[model samples]
Target: MENFFDQYRDEVQPALKSKLEEFILFGYDSVTEEELWQYLCKKKWKREREAKLLYQIVNDILSVKIGEYMNFATVEAFKSPDWFGNQGKDELSKLL
Candidate 1:
């Protein structure tokens, strides 16, 4: 059982690290490895749910960091015309 958990964590760490990089890119300066681990655990390690949870965390952080400037009602504002898409938007756009 112990090995199973260890191996599982090892398998997931790469994905978690990638997600953590995205969080850091969002200007979430306070996020730590432990916090990312907690977020993964909170999602029970489900991929889709974990992605949604990460998005929520990023949005929540943005809500605090950008305040009233964070909300956008337009759908086009959420999308990108180029191949990069919304995922390619930088931290500055998140603030805008």
Candidate 2:
């Protein structure tokens, strides 16, 4: 079961990563330079990429996709109290 979970995670990581990059770039184009740069740095696309993959892998063991499970993580990452970060939800909301 664990091996199968790991395999599924590997498969989905790239797709999620690509989608996140698109989301970030979309925001970059629409927002001002300072805000865009702040969003980019805070989200740390690579870190978010890895975290999102792990998040999906855990959720996939129960058959959940990114869209189905990303909200909580995004909210949590944003409301960290310790530091500021954007959830990158605007672009996602635009799609929906």
Candidate 3:
């Protein structure tokens, strides 16, 4: 599924840029085009079973809200093994 979407990277560049700009305007300065693309590929479009029209992809990118992206990012962060690098289970539990 991801391989199928990889072909649309260039075509969707503009929409990704537009969405990144929107995020920046809302004070999410750390957001990047690559991260936005990842969110779409991994979260927003993860369950897609068929090719989407270019316009549909563009709309999906442009329509993403900061909250949605943030939630996705937060979940991804928690999923990363490095998020708690070197921490013992007890230490992690204490932090939580």
Top TM-score prediction, candidate number: 3
TM-score of each: 0.36, 0.27, 0.82
* Ranked candidates (lDDT, high to low): 3, 1, 2
lDDT of 2 at 18: 54
Residue ranges of candidate 1 with Cα displaced over 4 Å: 1-7, 43-96
Query: lDDT per residue, candidate 2, 16-65, as tens digits?
Result: 45544554564523323233223333433324434345555434333423
Model 1 TM-score on a 0 to 1 scale: 0.36
lDDT tens string, model 3, 16-77?
88888888888998998888888988988889998899999889988998999999999989
Return the clash pairs for model 3, or none.
Answer: none
All predictions: root-mean-square deviation over Cα?
16.2, 14.2, 3.7
- Residue-level error in angstroms, candidate 1, position 21: 0.6
Best of the two (1, 2) by lDDT? 1
- Between candidates 2 and 3, name the one with more favorable TM-score: 3
RMSD (Cα, Å) of model 2: 14.2
For all candidates, the clash counts are 0, 0, 0
Q: Candidates' lDDT values, in order?
A: 0.45, 0.42, 0.86
Model 3 lDDT, residue 25, Cα:
88
